[model samples]
Target: MLSASEASIEAELKTKGLNAPRLTPADIDAAIVGEDFHVFPGTTMTVCALKLRNGFVVIGESAAASPENFDASIGRRIARDNARNRIWELEGYRLRSLLAANA
Candidate 1:
């Protein structure tokens, strides 16, 4: 891991035009489960990311549903899955492994 400082991460994100909102751990927890979102009648799972002071990004997402609602549920799953998949991809894992594990 690069282990860069939070300030550096913030700077880098800013340079990339990502407006990372400053949030406390509790805030992060709340955001994870869709607290930061408006209630959608057909809402399923919500997912988001948190940038830590240690330069590591913590991913927060809702879990799978029992009787899935394809649109929202799949959206949530894709959001969470994409974050994790990108990490493994960035670490040099082959796309085949990524797809296999996701299956």
Candidate 2:
């Protein structure tokens, strides 16, 4: 069952006509900047790179920090969300073009 947040996200994607291809951890290359508890006191930054089947590459970066410690996954999730938002923006243009054609 999809959680409320998941359902909402799905609906938003569908409404925007943004369909993202499946991406696995292996398909994404991640780079972490600022060592946890070393370089950055309590923050971690991650940059994720994904190569699309269309021969285009998209990169996203995010920084996250917790009160007690730094969570690497948090940064990764933020970066992934950033990349998805970029994809949505690109897809929006395509949707506009399609609408213009059909009109």
Candidate 3:
């Protein structure tokens, strides 16, 4: 479902004059400063760096949420994703350690 939504959005972006760049995982990792992962009940939240065309980068949240009672978990994931994005922009290496430690 999430992949479908992502594809839908990507298609929409192309329609809106945005092109999808072919980015490798290594390129994405090189552009990323940090990430945050959270799990709650039946949901999983992951925030990571996404490299776009023309050297642009954005933070992306990949979530797997339960069909029922999704609001809370979804909202939490959004908030966390936003916060992590900000923190990554500021404290570049803090999240790197956390990510590596987890790995």
Candidate 4:
């Protein structure tokens, strides 16, 4: 969950035409996992990749373990954030190219 301030920042960014992808807890929970998409665990980090139906692959990674934060939930959130960031970047590029072509 985003704090009030964080949500406001995100809203401001979006209003400025920034490409931002927001994923709720429910969205993360409902994320599909199979041969095409899955989380890969490493010794120091966890990497997750989702293969979209449209053949786009979004990847994310997070620290596997932290001394100060032992909760797995934090890592999961980080991974999801990373994934969404990648998605936003790709979408932004696509949109730019599309607008350029239309112009």
Candidate 5:
């Protein structure tokens, strides 16, 4: 797996991504500046917060109906993935807006 800051990855992404006329994984990845996670006390609830470059925050949640099924690692990953999915929609809209403005 390539780290996000690698020049080769960024170069390739910029070259191919700009002309695609749609949101790309690189685009979404680029927008994320920070991530935070939390679990509610005495509950099987997990929360993930993604901080974007523009200072906007998106949140995602995961909960287990039963304590027996709750796993810390799994819950955190699920919550983070849920938050990551929202970034796609937000980035898609941003891409669309940019496209519209340039048209």
Candidate 6:
């Protein structure tokens, strides 16, 4: 399910007549075959590596200003989000290329 903001954007898109193929959440999940995360030793830095189905890897990082203020959960979440953001662009490009080819 899309978040409220996303839903709103989707609705607006429909109103403006943008019915072209889009990169949905399911597409992102389907593209990702494996995921791994790491938190650096003695630091608040976290990194997430997402492996796509085509063997490409996308990496994302998160870091807290002070180790004392860092939470592993938050760091991992943020890092994963950053990684996922990259997938959107990659997948979008793939979709566009396929569309152009078929045009």
Using lDDT as the measure, the top candidate is 6
TM-score ranking from best candidate downward: 6, 5, 4, 2, 1, 3
Cα deviation of 43 in candidate 5 (Å)?
0.8
For candidate 2, report its TM-score: 0.54
Q: Per-residue alpha-carbon lDDT of model 2 for 1-103, expressed as tens digits? A: 2346656866787799886553222223221222221224444767766555555656677765554555667667667666655655555666577778978
For model 3, what is the alpha-carbon lDDT of residue 49?
50
- What would the TM-score be for candidate 6 when compared with the true structure? 0.84
lDDT digits (tens) for residues 3-83 of candidate 3: 465567657776897653343223433555544444445555545453433445455565545545445456556754554
Off by more than 4 A, model 1: 1-47, 50-54, 58-70, 93-103
What pairs collide in candidate 5? none
The clash numbers for all candidates, in the given order, read: 0, 0, 0, 0, 0, 0
User: CA lDDT of each candidate?
Assistant: 0.46, 0.55, 0.50, 0.58, 0.85, 0.88
Model 1 Cα displacement at 41 (Å)? 12
Q: Judge candidate 3 at residue 7 and give its lDDT.
A: 66
On the 0 to 100 scale, the lDDT of residue 56 in model 4 is: 60
TM-score, cand. 5: 0.78
Runs of candidate 2 exceeding 4 Å displacement:
1-3, 9-43, 65-68
Ten residues in a row with the worst lDDT in model 6?
1-10
Q: Which runs of model 3 end up more than 4 angstroms from their true locations?
A: 1-70, 93-103
Maximum-TM-score candidate: 6
Q: Give residue 55's lDDT in candidate 3 (0 to 100).
A: 45
Model 3 clash count equals: 0
- Sort by lDDT, top down from the best: 6, 5, 4, 2, 3, 1
lDDT of 1 by residue, 1-101 (tens): 22245457656777898753343223323333221221235555566454433455645465346535546645555565445444443334344556668
Query: What digit string (tens of lDDT, one per residue) describes model 4 on residues 38-75?
Result: 34443446566766545666778787455465446666
lDDT of 2 at 75: 67
